[model samples]
Each structure stands twice: as structure tokens, then as C-alpha cells.
Target: MNSSKPERRKTREVRIGSTAIGAENPVAVQSMTKTLTTDIEATIAQISRLENCGCNIVRVAVPTKKDTEAFAKIAAQVNVPLVADIHFSAQRAIEAIEAGASKIRINPGNMRSWQELDEVIACAKVNKISMRLGINEASIRNLKEDTPSRERTGLMFEEMSEYVREFEKRGFCEIVLSAKSVDVNRTIEINRKFSEGFDYPIHIGLTHSGLPEDGIVPSAAAVGSLLSEGIGDTVRISLAGKPENEIITAQDILASFGLYEKKTPRIVVCPTCGRCMIDVLSLAREIKQAVQEIQKPLKIAVMGCIVNGPGEAADADLAVCAGSGKGYIYRGGKKLAVVPEAELLAEFSKQINLLVAE
Candidate 1:
């Protein structure tokens, strides 16, 4: 399916500010602002950078009235839709809606009573905004003691399903559901079960995926698996780094499944072994740095040996198959030249320049 088009899961399309999610829409990439919500300029700058990095949506924390005030100003200035993250307060949720938030994220399981939850839903309906109704395991009330893995994920499904129905009962349908756990497999499983039981759009991501280097794999395995199976409509890779890095990681996941077709560069490096004579890792690192800013959908491969390198290089737009003392250059899958090891960088750079120019 990576090489062919996939039949995406169908769900009711819901608009989040200027963009739409669910059936027939591209799976949106979103990230949160790391700056303080009270600092309008800093928050706006972060959102602008994320936008430049191709983030489809941005969320900001609104834990105080001052942040809510700043949020309104930021919304008025930014081009992309902003989602207000609300926790432990319903009045603040109402205030955020009035402040021009395109959507609001609230975990109903965290609410002490349905009274406040109902009021928030009413506010969203009145303001014509969308809601991301989530049921985080940590927030669930009175979770059955010593629950089995099956029952735990099922509980998540039940929590999300019940919350969604309650919103529908109050005549609110512009909803995106989420059920996440720090456990990657559980995140994947719950999202699938949640999707099968409802037609509402689902927002998928791992809860508190740690730092970038360690989080990338778990985030991808959870979010990427769902997207590949026609599950996620909108996504965020929750990481402890620059929010823009989350955008990069999310886009990379979408791109891997052929779901995203943005002008981003991709690198294909062979896992070097004893067969490798030249320094493959160092060359690949340099190549990664060199093409970081390239805004073209180019595939560059760095292979270690002629054994499998040439065959793999045949599939890239530009590639180099390094042998003992020389490297064979490939352009558009055809052998262009065989250069000495000392001249490999120059030849690879030349081919890349030509590709970019085209």
C-alpha cells in the first residue's frame, strides 16, 4: 500500500477553522506552541514558524484569563486556525471560544461533572467552533482495578464513545474524538476500536512522547500505523522539543505512507556493514545537513557498497554507491559517472544542484 493508493477510512468531515478533516481531506499535521500564552509576540512567532514548517493547525495553552486575552490578539494576527487547550475549567473554555479559537481540546474524563462539560459543548455550538473530545487513561474516573489490557483499551473506547454521544445529545456534532495512552500499542488499538464504533473524526497521537530522539519512533509507530490503515484525520506528535520539530516529525510520518505530497527532501541511506569500505555514516550526515532546506520532493540515497547499493541507488533521483576506492554516481536511476572517493562529494553535490534546478 505504500506504493499504491489506499482507500482511506470514511468519517464525517468537520471544519477546523480554515481547514477540514475527516473523509476526503488530507490528514492534517498539527503542533502546540511552546511559548507562554501571555507572551503574545513569542507565541505568535512560534506559530508563524510552525506555519512555515507546514503545520496545518496550532494549539496554545489557555490556563489563565491573561492567556485568553493574548490568544484573541494572536488569533487576529495569525493566518492559521488556533486551537485553545482547556483543562480544569469550563468558563475558560467559553472564554476561549469567544476569543476566536477555531477548536477547543477538552478531556471529558477530567471533568468533575457533566454540568460543566455540557456548558462547554453549548458554548462551542453557539460559537460555531469544533471540539476535540478526548478520554485520556490518566483522566478516567474509577478505572476498574487490575484491569486487563483488553479491558483497559475497551474502557478508553467506552469513555470516548460516551463523551461523543453526550455532545451529540446536546445537538453538537462538529467533533473530533481522541483516545490515547503512553503505550504505543494501546494508542493504536484504541484509535482503531474508537473509529469502528463512531463516524466522528478522530485526532490521533501518543500521550507525552518524551524527547525528539526517543519519541520519534514511538510517535511514528502510533500515529503512522493509524494513518496507514485509514484511521487518523488530524495528528500531533507530542514531543519535548521545539514545536517545529514536531511538525517535521509529523510531516515525515505522513510522507512515508505516501499520504503527504509536500515539497520535502528525503534521504535513503544503507545500513553500513563490514562490506562498507568508505565512511558511509559521515557522508550521510553531511548530505542530511546539506539538503535540510531543499523544498523539493527529492529522494537522495547514500549507499555503502556496490553489492546492494547500485540496485538501491537505481530507485533514487540522485545516489552514490561507494566501493573500495571509488563511487558510482546515479542520476534519475541511471549511472552517470564513477568518481574517486576524494571526488564523491563534488559529484553528489553537482547532481543535487541539477535536480533542484530542474
Candidate 2:
């Protein structure tokens, strides 16, 4: 009910096991497992970690027969819906469907033939599971060598359109479509086209986004841009590091647009400057750790100086304006108390509990 939330693009709802995509549902945050699918126990453990971190759907690579076998065992043990990542093989896709995949991602550009696609589609229809027509720009074979960036997107869109028509022709409507590019602008442009071109739920993200430190900005720009325009139904941040980081980063992007149901406190801290009096950075760090167990949306601002402190406090549910040896606490933009620096953490914890109780 927040006015800050974007008006979501209305699309046909598709159920992936227990999770629903599109319609009025909150934008789902998803991540792929990094562990080898052949390691069934490790895959299950990773899925558990992802579920604990609020991943709505967990994808695992089923590129090999052994991987699909492991996927079946892993799917049986996890509560989260499993998506089989299939590439180059319709047999693998069919195996994954029989292996209990709630959804499967296959790039139509790479499929050998229409018959193969039809076979995969028929299996998914019979299994009553969903499929993702995932189109990665890099995989489009017809793209001429040294094609311009703009032309590349056109080719991507063309490939996706052909596949979509095939899927629809086969009466396969339980589909989620994705057109991904590593380039930020192209990623946004392609997904926008998908939104306008089809009523299927769109999964948005950049593929091959590098390590976390370097990937976050571009990932945010590509994903956050689509989300702001009400374009994406589900998102993956696609960092090169841990998949948990991917989930966390995706949640942060969704939260920015008010599309995520945040179960953790929202911590806002000022970047301390020369005008700051107390150790705002230290205090903010302490507050972050102290509030780890909080499971509700609480805006706690830790400001270093008087200049921006009061202004930020007006918006935050709870705020601390630090002075020389003491800190001023604000609840609902009204001054609650002034506590010595030593008791700031203790006093702030007390106030947080009271607010939570209320």
C-alpha cells in the first residue's frame, strides 16, 4: 500500500510449485545454486542456505545426466521450487521434468530443432510444470560477426519472438520469458520489449555480471531500471560469487522499489564528514549487528551531524543525532531522549523493543 511502490505490469499468473509469479504478487527474488548439482548433499545444503536467505526459487544446472539425477534428489529434500537449467539438450530437459523440476529454463536459440522443443514442451505440459524461454544475447547463433550493439538486441528480440510463437502454437502458456544481456542498456531495452511484446511474466537480470564488488552497480542499474518501470516479475542479481550474495543483492534492489517484503530492519546511516561530532560509523556498525534478529521493517538512521540529522529523522521511524559526548534519539521525528555515548546502544535497543512491542 506504499505509494512509493511502482505500478506492476499485469501479466498472467504462473505457478511454479508453491510460488506464484506475476499478477499482484510481490516481485520474487531468486538465485541459482553455485554448488555442483552432482554433489547432491552439497546442492541440498546450498538450497537450504538460499531458502533461509529468502530465495523464492532456486535454480541448478542440469547440463549433464548425472546432474539431473542429483537434481531429483535435491528437489525432493527442499521446500523451495527447483528450476532445472537446461542447455543444448532436450533429453536433459525431459529428464529434469521427470526428475521433479517445478520449472525449467531453456534457451530456444540453442535448441537443435523445433521437434526437440516440442518434445520438451509436451513433457512440461504433461508434468504440469512451467518453463522459461530464456534468451541470452550471447547465445544467438545467427548474429552476424561484429554486429552493432543495437542490432544485437534486435536479433535477440527476433529469436525470442520466434520461440514464443512456437510455444504458444503448442498451447504452452505457462511460460516465463527472459531476454538477458550483460550490457546494462541492452538488458533494460530487451526486457522492456518483452514486457510490451508478451503477457508472460518477465524474469530480469544481466548474465555474467562479474564479482560482487564490480557487479553490483551494473546489476542494479539493469534490474532496478526495469523494476522501476514495473517490468520484472522475478529477478536474479547474477553475481559471480556466492549465490546467497545474489539473493541478498536482488532483495536489496526489490526493497529499493518497495517491491520486496523486507523481514530485516532497514538501516540508514550517514556518511560521516568533517562536521560530524561523535563516532557515527562506529555507532552505525554497532546498531547493524545489534538489530540482526529484528524481523520487521524498522528504519533506523544513525546520523553524525546536526545538519542532516533532523531532516533524516523526519522520515525514519527511529533516529540518532550524535553530538560531542551524547546522542539525541528521535522516535517518529520527535525527540525521545538524550543519552550519554556509552549508553547509546543500550538505550537504543530499549527503544527498539518498545517500538516493536507497540
Candidate 3:
């Protein structure tokens, strides 16, 4: 475990279906399906893709009874655990629980009243499903329109604590908590407060994180800060791109920190400068797309100049350093073979397969 504050609150282990969150379990990566839940086939297909991309949990919107009905079939067909994102409807939550959702994410303030909240809690308990109390900045209760900036996050924290206390009061401890805000700094602050106040595993992410280049960096920074402090147990990298993109982003972030093992080759490519080399960018793209289906951990480097390439990438398990129209294949910092530029990718692939097979 990463070094954390000595007084870190101990969170109860909550099982979302067969997967356990909190209590020393491996941090999970989750993504929501953009496909409408009623379109079971599309939802299942999207989820299947996410599963292949290493998404541990998948969430689908269950806005109505019909969507709840679809959850049964989708849950049955999908390989990963499923979560139902429910809003404003305890009845739908009940239906989704009956239909086989592993977890339900609800905004406590939106539920009709105390009775409705009780009904939702009861259904979750009876079904033995976990609940995620998802509280966002905009959804926080009892906040004045002109509240001071310094107290805004405190108000959000208070609301989250109230819901968590309510869930505990109902004798239901199977809970995951998320407090997301559009502002990355505020998101970090709220989670930091929660970490001090409670032991429940936190699901941290910046809501509405923009596009790939711009969005991924900040989102990773925010989540990374919390994770480095041993604060987050699961995370979602919300991006405007495809859901698979989010999964890949999450995997990369974890891998960069040495928190996740690469299930596929870890390609280390140098950005081509004025070194004058074969099409390094195009070659890297081709290799990445070509070997996307492989699932073993290996490191491959594509460098522009041989002088610094092999020496700089000496730590790579296998590397191809390009020079002029030729490339040298090196393993463990020793040159093994020289191949024409055109055949470099194929030779690299062959070597990777052999290494992975062994």
C-alpha cells in the first residue's frame, strides 16, 4: 500500500457482486455506458468492449422501469459487474435491484423523502447489493446561492457526510462514496476532507474533464493526488471520447505510477526531432494498432537516433532504435540484430510474441 496518514480511517469492505471495493482490494476502474439502457444490445456491446479494455465495473443509466427491466438481460450477458445509475425514483431502484444490478448509485437528496430513501435502502439490503452515494457539487443540499467560496466545499462535505450517516443508520454499510466537482482543486479538497472524516473507500474523478490531450492530464493529476495519498479505492476518468478511451487513459495513469501492470506491451517511443529518421510517428501508430489485441506485459521502445536511443532506452525489455533507413533490435541493452526500416515493426511484433509466449 502507498504511504498514507497514520490515522487513515478504516473503511468497511463492500462487495459489488463478486468484486470487493475498499478494505485492501485492488483499486477498480469503472466507466459508464453511453448507450441507452433500453437498447440492451447496444449497451451490452459497449460493455463488452469496455470489458476487453479492462474496465472492472460498468454503469448503465436506469431512468425508468423499462431500463430497469433491460438491466437483467444486460447484466446476465455482460462479463463485468454492473451498476445501475438511478435518480429520483426509489421504485426504479427497487426494480433494478430485483433485476440483478450489483450496485445502485443514487443521489440521496433527490429521493422523494425519508420513506422513499428507506425503501431504496431496504431493497439494496434485501438484494445484498452495494450502494454508491454519489454527491456532486451541484447536487449538495442546503447550500445558499451566494455561499462563500471557502465554505462551498465544506457544505458539500457536510451533505456527503449526512448521506453516509443515513446509510449507516439503516444498518447498511455496503457503500461507496464519490464527491465530484468540475473544479479539480475543489474535487481534491472535498475528497481530502472525506478521507479525514470517514473510512469508506472513495471513488475520485473530475466531472466533465474535457478532451483527450487537455482533459486527461488534469483528471489524472487530481485523481493521482488522492491515490498517492492512499485516499481513492476506485476511479473513473471521464472524457469526451469513446468509453474505451477512458479505460485506456485510466490504465495508462495507473501504469505510469507503477500501480498497474501492463497487460500488453508498454511502448516507449521517442518524439522524432531533427534526428532525421524513418517515419517514427507513423511506425509507432501502426505498431500500437497492430498489437492492440495482445495481453502480455512487455516494453518496446522506438527511438529516432541510435546514439541516445539504445542507451536511453536501455531498460526496455526489447527495443528498436532507428537510424537513417535501418533499425537495430536490442534486448537487455545489447544489440541482437539489424533490420531494414520497413521490416522493423514485423520483427518487433515477432519478438514480442516470443517473449510473451515464454
Candidate 4:
């Protein structure tokens, strides 16, 4: 019953195109494009899809100049801010920066030397682009060198700190820090250390996760753990399937903790038992599909039994407690009308639609 809000960590704000992240801004939800960045049309279409799903920022991979060429056009056509994912290649990072990337993600462990970093940082500074110093576990040399699992977070912290210091030394302070591991505990610990030591915004995610269907639980666990304590600024749910699914996954995590900006009715349906009447499961599914796009913050309840229905849904904006062949509609615990079973869903839909319009 406790709904205490978590305190967010204060960090420097970094701008990506038109979007502002960190500095206690509403935690931004982001996802990546799965299509090859060289496929300009498909990449733009996917970014548009993610934008429609309430995604705040989107990252696209730029492994080569061709992708950056496509990225230039993609950035011109899309409204959401774009981050170019660059691996160890400094040349590619510079190219993506020139092509209009609002932000660039670089793995600190993968970079060869300070000179290589200086090249990319100089380019980012000139272009006025923010940088995400992504410290990934798999890419880290210490982790690959038979480092004990328990010591990985420490190594990540060390690596991230070194990169952040380098960025500052070069006079490029528009930095966002991220430390990601497949293990949720490591991800949480590394970010906690990062937050305590620096004021830069931190991006949160798991580097390698299972397939989309199987990835949500762990990805949510890692991201939600950090965000709940106010340690994360931007989030990406790294899933193994359609990149847009990552947006939905990220939304579910942020919404569970009440940190997301995009709001809609969250309908609660009773898991029916023998005390139940009416087909609550079918009705709930249909209503969920219908209201997926509504942005208004509303709580709805579809209960199969009348005994604990209205009282349980007392906080809901709208509710329908169904009986054997009739249903009672309630608004904020006050009954409005009785309707036949077949019309219950129809009436409930109309009531919520009216509420949304209001």
C-alpha cells in the first residue's frame, strides 16, 4: 500500500537534439533500430514506429561510412533524437558525428588509446554532440582476462572513471556514463559507484540478454533497480528481437516505478477463481488492446465478482464489476449504472473514452 516516491540523483543535464536528459528530468525511455543503418528507408520507418510507441530517443548502429551516409538522411527525416552506436572505430565515430548524430555511444574498453579518444572527443566537441561512455562487461579487457565475477563491477567502475576523467581533461564535458553487465547486480553496483563519484547523467541497460520474450524480466530487473533508486537518466532495454519491443519493455519498467512521462490507463483485472462470474479474462484483453495508445493517466478495473470489486477498485477512474448476466459500472467507487453482460464491455469502453476526452 505504500507508494513513496524514490529520490532522483542530481546530475548534469545533457541535450540530444531537442530532448533534455538527466538533471532530474523525467527518466527518458529509448530503444535501438534493428535494421541495418545503411537501409535508410527501413531504418527511418523503424525509428518512426518507436517514436509512435512513446519512445523518447532512438539509437542506430553506424559501423561504416555507408551507414553514416544513410544516417544523415535518417536524421533529416525523423523527429526523435538519434544516437549513433560506434564501436572501436574512431573514423566511424567522426563520420557519424558529421552526419548529424545527436549523441554517440563509445565503449571505453574498446578504444585503443588516449589519442584515439582525443580524436573522437574533439569531433564531438566541435559538433556539440553529447557522448555516452558505455562501459560494457564483455568489451572490457579485465573481464576477459579471467577476472573474478565478483570483481567485474569494480573494474567497470575503474574503466568508466578513467574515460570520464579523460573526457574532462580534453574539455569535453557533455558526457553521459553507462556501465552495463548481463548480471543485474553488477549493473546496479557499477552505476551506484558512478553516481557517487561523478555528476554526469547515466544510461542504464544490460549488454547481452536473452530473446525478447525471455529478456524482459532481467532487463527490467536491472533497469528498474537503478532507476528506482534514481541512478539512471536514460534507459535502453537490450533485447534480442525487434528493437521496437525494447521500447515497450522499457516503458513497462519505467511505468512500474512511476518514473515514465507517457501515461495511460493501467487496467487491473482480477485473476478469477470460483467466486467469479463473467469472462473477465477476455474482456480485460480486449480493453487493453483498445486503450494502448491513450496518454492520459487513468486506472481501470474489470472485476469478475462484485464482493470485493468496487472497494478494490476504489482508486480506479473507472471500473466494471460483472455478475452472471449483468454488470455494475462504477466511477471512483460510486456505481453509475447496470448493464447486460454483452453490453458491459461496450459501455465500459464508452465510459473510458469519455473520460479520456475530458
The best candidate in terms of lDDT? 2
Query: Candidate 4 on 77-176: residue-level lDDT in tens?
Result: 9999999998878988998999999999988667777788888988898999999888778776656666776688888777888887777888898989
lDDT of 1 by residue, 1-358 (tens): 1355456899999999999999899999999999999989999999999999899999999999998999999999999999999888898898999999999999877776899988888889888899998778776755776877788898887777788778888889999998878999889999989878999889999989999999999999999888878899999999997998898888878877888875867888899898997999999898888888898887888999988887778778889899889999998779999999989988888888888987
Sort all candidates by TM-score, best to worst: 2, 1, 4, 3
Q: Candidates' lDDT values, in order?
A: 0.88, 0.90, 0.84, 0.85
Q: Which stretches of model 4 miss by more than 4 angstroms?
A: 1-4, 144-146, 261-263, 289-295
User: Per-residue lDDT for 247 in model 2?
Assistant: 90
Candidate 3 residue lDDT tens string, 110-181: 898989989888888888999899988877877787876559899888888888888888898889999888
lDDT of 4 at 9: 95
Write candidate 2's Cα lDDT for 236-292 as tens digits.
Answer: 999987899999899888888878767888889998889998888888989999889
Candidate 1 vs candidate 4, TM-score winner = 1
Q: Report the C-alpha displacement of residue 27, candidate 4, in angstroms.
A: 0.9
TM per candidate comes to: 0.94, 0.96, 0.89, 0.93
Off by over 4 Å in 1: none
TM-score of model number 4: 0.93
Pairing residues by index, what is the TM-score of model 1? Answer: 0.94
| Candidate number with greatest TM-score | 2
**What RMSD does each model have against the real structure?**
1.8, 1.6, 3.2, 2.2
